[model samples]
Target: MTLLLLLDDPAQPGVVELQSLTDDGLPEGSVSVAADDLASAVREREADRPRWVWDDTSRRYPPLLAAGVRVERCHDLRLCHAILRRSVYSQSSTLAGAPPGPWDGPREPPPVEGSLFDDVGPSVVADPLAELREQLAAVAGADEPGRLRLLLAAESTGALIAAEMQRDGMPWSVETHDALLVSLLGERPRSGRPPKLEALADEVRAALGQPSLNLDSQPDLLRGLRAAGCDVESTRTWEIKALEHPVRDPLLAYKKLSRLLSANGWAWMEAWVHDGRFRPDYVPGGVVTGRWATSGGGALQLPASIRAAVRADPGWKLVVADAAQLEPRVLAAMSGDTAMAAAGRKADLYQGVVDAGIVETRSEAKYAMLGAIYGATTGPSAVLMPRLTRAYPHAVALVEAGARAGERGDVVSTWLGRTSPRPDAAWQAEHAAASAEGAGADDVRAARRRGRDWGRFTRNFIVQGTAAEWALCWMASLRRRLLELDGRPHLVFFLHDEVMVHAPAEVADEVAVAMRSSAVEAGRLLFGATPVEFALNVAVVDSYDQAK
Candidate 1:
C-alpha cells in the first residue's frame, strides 16, 4: 500500500490532507483528518503496512512517535530525490534533468511540534504527488532499477531510525559523567582551567624552559619547542610523540585532557543531556559515501574515555554488537574472490590471511588488506601488497580498476549503484594543462600527483560505500527483528558498524541472536549465495564500556 501525506495547512490548523495511491501510483481516493485524529488515522492505516510517502521522514515521523504511533515503512521523498539527482544510474530520468528547486537543499533541521508546518519554504506547499511520481519514474527508468530502488529504500529506513533514536535518546548517567570528569581532570573551577590541566600546562612549560610560553598558541609553542632543540614541523600529537624531549609526555597529556574538557565536558552535558537521556541530532546520508554524520552533539565520535557514562536502566542490559572486519568482508563478498571469501569464513579474517601465507603476522595482514582497499603506496602496506595481490587477485583487481578509472577522471558506483562524485572543474583544468603540447615538467608532475590523490579516494570509495550499504541493510533487518521480541528492546546508539540495543536482561540474548542473524540476512540481500561471512562480536553488559 502507498499513501501520500501532505503537511497540514497552517490555515486549517489541525486538518491533515492525505491521498491513497495504488501500487502503480494512480490515486484511489483522498482523505482529511484533524490534528487530534491524525495519529488514529495513521495507526489504522498501519494495519495494512502502507509505505507512507512524505516530504521528509525526519520532519514527519517524530510527531507520530510522540503520539505513540509507529509505522512499518516509509519512502522519504527528499532523501530519495537527493540520491536520484546525482546517481549515475538515473542520469536519463526527468528528475535528473530538471532545474534545482526546493528539493535540492540540505534537510532543514527538524522543526518543533505544533509549528511543524511553519518556516517551511516552497517544498512544504509544492505538489508532493507530482514529486512522488517523478521520483518513482526516476528509479524505474534507471539502468539498474532494482539496485537504485533498494538503495532508496534502505536510505529512507535509515532516516526513520535516526529520528527514532534521537527521540528515544541514549541512556546517560550525568552523575557518572561528572565523576569521570573530576577523576581525570580535577574539580570544576569558577573560571580558569581545572587543577590537573593547569598542572600539566606548567609541567610542559617547565620542561621546554619557556615559562612564558602560551601553550594554546600553535606558533608560539612551535617556536618554544624549536628553541629548546626539538626540531618538529607541527604540533600534531604523532609528531610530538616521535620527538625525544621531556615536554612530550606532558604536552600529550595536556592535549588529551583539554579535548575531554572542551568536547565532552560539563558544558556539553548541560547542553545535550537532559532527564537521563543524551539525544544527538543525527544527519542521515550526510557523508558522500552514505555514512551518517551528527549535525550536533558529536555522536559519531563518542570518545572511549566517556563511554562509561552510558548505562542501562535498572532491569535492562545493553546488547552491543560490532561487525568484525566489515569492509574487508564486504570487499570479499562483492568481488566474489573465492580465496578472500574463504579467508573470512572464520571469526578472525586477518588471522585467516596469515594462515593462507599471505603475510607474516596479523598486523601485516591488516595493513595489506587496508592498503589494497585504500590505495596505500608506501611503508609496510606497500611492501606487503604483492603477496596479497598474488593470493587474492580478484579483490585486488576490483579496487585497482576503480583507482585507474578515477585517474582518468571517471566516476565509479558501489555494488548497489550509489555513484562516486566526479572530479570538479578545477581538477579537469589542471589535467588538461598538463596534457597540453608545451606543458612544463612541474605542471606534469603536479597533475600526476593530483591524479594519484584522487585515485586513492576512488580506490576506497567503492569498498567503503558498499560497506556502508551492507550496514544499512543489517540495521534495517535488526530493527524489524527487535520489534518482534517480547521485551521493549530499542536501539540506543549506533556507530559506523556497531549497534547498541537496550533490552531486558532476559531478552539481551535474543537481541544478540537478532544482531548475528541480521548480518547473515544483510549479506544475502547484498551478495546472494556468497560464501563470505559477516561476523560480529556481541556483548551484553550493564554499561557501554563493559561491552569491549
Candidate 2:
C-alpha cells in the first residue's frame, strides 16, 4: 500500500497528515492518520517500503535522513511536474498545455534551522492532491510514458541524493588545506598579502618599470603593459603567456595567486569548511542539460591544488569512481553505431580510434569527435572532421542533425525526454529581421552569429543531457546498492560524472564493485541490449587528491 504524505497545516494542525491516494489521486482506505510524531510515522512507513508521494524531495528527505530514517521510494511532484511539463513527449498533456502556476516557482532552498520540511498553508497548495492528479495525467499522456516516468524517478532520486550529500558533508581537512596554501603561496600573514604573492607583485612592478603600478586593477595594468610595449591584448592567461617580456612570468604568477586568494583563500576556508567537512549547497537540475550546479563554495569547480584537503576520516576510505569517455559512449549508444561502440570499449576512446586507423593520432581523433558534436566549422577539428565522418558516420550524423535542427530554430529532445527550449521572442524577432528584405550587413552577421551559437548549444545539448540522465541513473542505482549493504558506505560527494563514497576500509573493495555494477545497470536501463559499455575508472584512496 502506497502512502500519500500531505504537508498541510490545516489538515492536522502542526502535524503531517498521511492519506492513502488512489491511482487517480482520490482519497481511499479510510485509515488516514495525523502523523504528529513525524519520525516515528516515517520510520513505520519506511519499513513498509511505501512510495511516499510528496511535493519536494530536497525539502522532505533531509530530516528523515538526519533522524536515521530511510525510505525505499518517493514521488517528488514538483520535480516530476517540471520534467513532464517541458518534455516534448508530454506536449499533448494538460500540464504542458496550461499556463505556469505556483509549482513553476523557483524551488525554496532546503531549510537550514527552521521547521524541517514542515507543512505549508492552505493557499500554498491550491489543491495539491488535484495537482498530483494532473501530473499523473500528464505522465499518462506522454508519447513514451515509460521513458518519461523513468526520467522522473531518476530525477527525484537525484534530489534525494543532493540533500543527503549536503547533510553528510564531504570529508575535508583544514590542516592539509592550510599546509598546501602555505607551500604554494606562503603563510597566512597577520595582514595584507601573502609573501609569495607580494614577491610576485614586486617582480611584476620591476619588469614593467613602474614601481607602484596597481597590478590588481585591470585597466591600470593594461596601461602599464602598453607603456612597456608588452604586446598583450587582455589580461587572459593565454594572451599573457604569448608575450616575450619579463612581466609575463610574474604576471602569470600574480594571476594564479589572485585567483587562488579570491576563489578559495583563507576567508573561503573559514566560510565553506566546517567540522572537517565541506558542505556545499547543491542545486540539482540547475543546468539546462540536467547537470547539477552549486549555490556556493565553488563545489563544482574545486581546484586540483586544493584537493589535498579532501581527506577521509580515520579508518575510512574514499572510493572515487568516474565514468571514462561518458559523452562518446552515450553517443554510440544513442546512435546505435557499432563501430563507435567498439572503439569506446578501450580505456582511451580516442586512442582506440587511432588504432582503428581512422585518424593519424589520438589528439586528431579527440578534436575531430569533439568538434563534430560541438558544431565546429573551421580550424584543426574541422580539418579532421571528414575523416571522422567517414569512420563513424552515424555518430557524426546524429550531432549534425541536432545542429541542423537548432539552426532551423527547432527544439530537440534528449534520449529519455528533456527537450531543448524553443528560441525566445527576442531571438525570433532578430532572426525575422535578418530574413526581412533589405536587412543590414550588421543585422545579417549578428543573426548568423546567433544561429551558430545556438546550433553549437543544441548540438552539444543532446549528448550532454543524455549523459546527465545516465549519471542520474548511475548514482541512483549506486545509492540503492550501497543501501543494501549494512549501511556502512555513505556517498559524500558527487560531480557530473563522478562520485566519491566515504566507506570503512574493509568495504572499499565492495564499494568499487558496486560502482562498476551500478554503471552496468544504468547503461542497461537506458539502452537495453546495446553493445556500448559505460566504463569507469575506480580508485580507492585515503584522500580525494589521489583520484583523478
Candidate 3:
C-alpha cells in the first residue's frame, strides 16, 4: 500500500489531504483522484476543480500545491528528515540581532519608585523650586553679574555628584545627598580668610536672620536652618553635638553648612576639570578581556554633593543606557542546551531555570549554576551542585569537565584568543608522585593530587576571560557609534562593562540609539553566525546615580 499527503498552496494558506492506496491498485478510502487532479479537473470543468481529495485506506492522492512541498509517512520520519536538512543547510544560530533604527522621541527613564531624594524632609518638598529661586535671588542680590558665587557653587556641586555616580553604582537618594553636604562642610575652621567665603557667610546668615556663626559646626547649623523651613532632623549622629552652641543660632548654622558644602564642592570640581572644561578621562582597553579601566581623578565617582554641577550644557542634555542580565543570556546561547535556552528566552534565565524544575528554588539554581561557571566552589556552590547535577547533566558536565581540567593544571582557551595560563611544575610534580602511590594512606594523597591535576583554574579563566572580551567589544562598539554622531560628544568615563559619554542635549536621543545599535553590532562581531541578543536601559540626568 502507498500513503500520500497533500497540502494547500505551498505559497499561500490552504487545506491538507491524506490518502492510502491498496496493494491491488484500487483507491480504498473516499474518492479517487487523478495524478494531475487540478489540471485534468480544470480541463473537464474549469469552475468545478476540487482543491483537495484523498483515499485514506489506499493512502494515495494527487499532488496539492507544488511538487517541492515536503513529503513523509510516519511522524518520526518527517522529524528526522527535517532535522537532517536543517543541520546540513541552516546557518549557525549564535549571531546577534539587527541594529536599532534612529530614535524618534525622547528616551527618558521611568520615574524610580523610592528614589534617594525621598528621604529629604517635607520642607524642601513644600516648594523646592520656590526655595531654590529665593536662595538664588538672595545670592544674586549680593553679587554682580558673572561674579555670582552661589550659582557657581551650586554648579560645582552638581558636577562632583555626577562624577561619583559614574564611578560607583550608588544611589542618589536624598539622605545620601544630605550626608554628602554635611561631610563636605563639616570642619572648615573660620580663618577669617578667603574674603569671598566670609562675605558669603555674612549674606547667608542675614538671609536666615541669625548671629555670626562658627562654620565648624556646619551640620548642626544646617539642621537649624532647614528647621526654620519646617524640615529638620539629625540624620547623621556623627555630625551632632549634645551641647547647645553659644556662637550662632541654629538657622545661621544650617545656612552656613549648606553654602559651604555647595561652595567647597564647586572649588574641588574646578580644580579637577583640566584645561577649561570638566572633561573626565576614559580608559578603553582597561580590563584583561577588553573591559574599561579607571585612570586619574576617579572620574567615575560622583559624590552626591557634586552631582548638581553635572547639568547638561546649555541647550544640551545627557542620555544614558545600560544592559539588563547580559551574562546569563550569553551563557544560555553559548551552551546550546535547548532546555536552558528555552528557559532563558522566556524571562530571567536564573529564575526560569528554577521554575523549570532545574533546581529546588531560584536562589539554589542561581548560586549553583553561576558558581559552576564562575569557579565559585567553597560558598554557595557547595549547597547548589547536587541539584544542578541532577537537572542539567549535559551543561553541568561541560563545566565539571572544565573544573576538573583546571584542577589538573591544564590550560584552557575560549573561542577567542584569550587563554588561561598553565599551572606551575610544583603542582604537576605532586600529581605525578601521587599517581605512583598504592591504595591506603597513599590513596588519599593520590586522590588529592588527582583533584589538583584537573584543570579547575584553567576552566574559569577560559569562561571569564572570554566573557570579558565580549564586554570589551560591547563598550568599544558603543564608543565608536557615539563618536560617529553629528556632535563630537566626549567619551569621558568607562568602567569595566560600562561607558559614559558627555554629549549635547538635543542629540541625547540619537546617542541612546547609537548605544543600542552598537551593542547588537558588538555581539555580531564576536559571535558571528551564532544567535545573540541584548537589552538596554536609558536615562537623562545630571548625575550617574540618577541615571539608574
Best prediction by lDDT: 1
CA displacement after TM-score superposition, residue 386 of candidate 2 (Å): 0.5
Clashing pairs in 1: 14-35
Clashes of 2: 0
What is the per-residue lDDT of model 2 for residues 235-307, given as tens digits with 9 covering 90 to 100? 8899899999999988998999889988998989999999988999898898988899998988988899889
TM-score of candidate 1 to 2 decimals: 0.97
Model 3, 158-205: lDDT tens per residue? Answer: 222223333222222343333454454543444533444455566545
Score candidate 2 by TM-score against the native.
Answer: 0.95
Which of candidates 2 and 3 reaches a greater lDDT? Answer: 2
Runs of candidate 2 with Cα error greater than 4 angstroms are 1-3, 11-13, 29-36, 118-124
Candidate 2, poorest ten consecutive residues by summed lDDT: 114-123
List the pairs of residues colliding in candidate 2: none
> lDDT (CA) for every model shown?
0.89, 0.85, 0.45
Q: Which ten residues in a row have the lowest lDDT in candidate 3?
A: 53-62
